[model samples]
Target: DARVTQTPRHKVTEMGQEVTMRCQPILGHNTVFWYRQTMMQGLELLAYFRNRAPLDDSGMPKDRFSAEMPDATLATLKIQPSEPRDSAVYFCASGTRGNTEAFFGQGTRLTVV
Candidate 1:
């Protein structure tokens, strides 16, 4: 079945550690987004891409967070020197251009102690 798959469904790490999350978007979906959810911010869009090209990442902390789509099927988000404040559920979503609906992955729950 076509689906968005996210790895490392749950993670716990010390502050200052590096965290890497992976996502495999559904085949043929040309748009992708990286989002973080927390009680304070609700759902926030951290990054977005279309046709494998990065379109926006303004919501992400440029100093420590990054999002990239290295190929058509893979999208990655990395946080270096992760802090406790970064704890949240990260999600990857994909959709076709012009489609109003987006398919979301299960999400990776991260906790930095």
Candidate 2:
């Protein structure tokens, strides 16, 4: 079975740095989601796309977070001007909304100093 894969499972950076995390969603899937997990925010939805079209990103911080689907199987999330408050486990998930179970990447644990 195909699965979503992520790179740089762990990342550490100082404040005001740029961080990019990559994800390869399952083949033939068209929906992708970015989520941040923390004790305070819990599991919060950052952004998502369906069939390469952006759906909603109201849960994300507009100034520092960006999510995109550049191709069928590739999705990426980037953060600029990162701060210590950005430390969290960033997860990439993909699925057919309302149809199948979402597949999650191993996750990129980002820590900003």
Candidate 3:
């Protein structure tokens, strides 16, 4: 059962509220990934960090979306003033350094009014 850990498996927030999602990458893993799944856009990679440093997050709304890794094991994604359009299943995955196989965690399903 080696996998990433995500908290608050589901969340319902009012529009304009802030939401934060958390993940604990597998121990010793140096790469973490975040993704979002939606009806229209399908599945898209939002951002990723290697060695706990963000490579790029252009796919996300720069003003509203943020991703960070406070340490090797923990990664976080936050949405400020959340909107209904932001409702989606957010997934967190991790892999060993330079490894291609990623282990995914049970996603956090977010709903905004």
Q: What is the lDDT of residue 60 in candidate 2?
A: 82
Candidate 3 per-residue C-alpha lDDT over 1-113 given as tens digits, one digit per residue, 9 for 90 to 100: 67899987999999999999999999988999999998999889999899999997877899999999998878999999899999999999999775798899999999999
Model 2 collision count: 0
User: What's the ranking of the predictions by TM-score, best on top?
Assistant: 1, 3, 2
lDDT tens readout by residue for model 2, 8-111: 89999999999999999888888898889998979888998999888899988899988888888788899998999999999999898676678899999999
Q: Which candidate, 1 or 3, has the higher TM-score?
A: 1
lDDT of 1: 0.96
Error of 1 at 79 (Å): 0.2
TM-scores of the candidates are: 0.98, 0.94, 0.96
Any runs in candidate 3 off by more than 4 Å, and if so which? none
> Which lDDT values do the candidates have, in the order given?
0.96, 0.90, 0.93
lDDT of 1 by residue, 4-105 (tens): 999989999999999999999999999999999999999999999999999999999999998889999999999998999999999999999999598999
Give Cα distance to truth, residue 88, candidate 3, Å. Answer: 0.4
Model 3 scores a TM of 0.96
Backbone collisions counted per model: 0, 0, 0
The model with the greater lDDT, 1 or 2, is 1
> What TM-score quantifies how close candidate 1 is to the native fold?
0.98
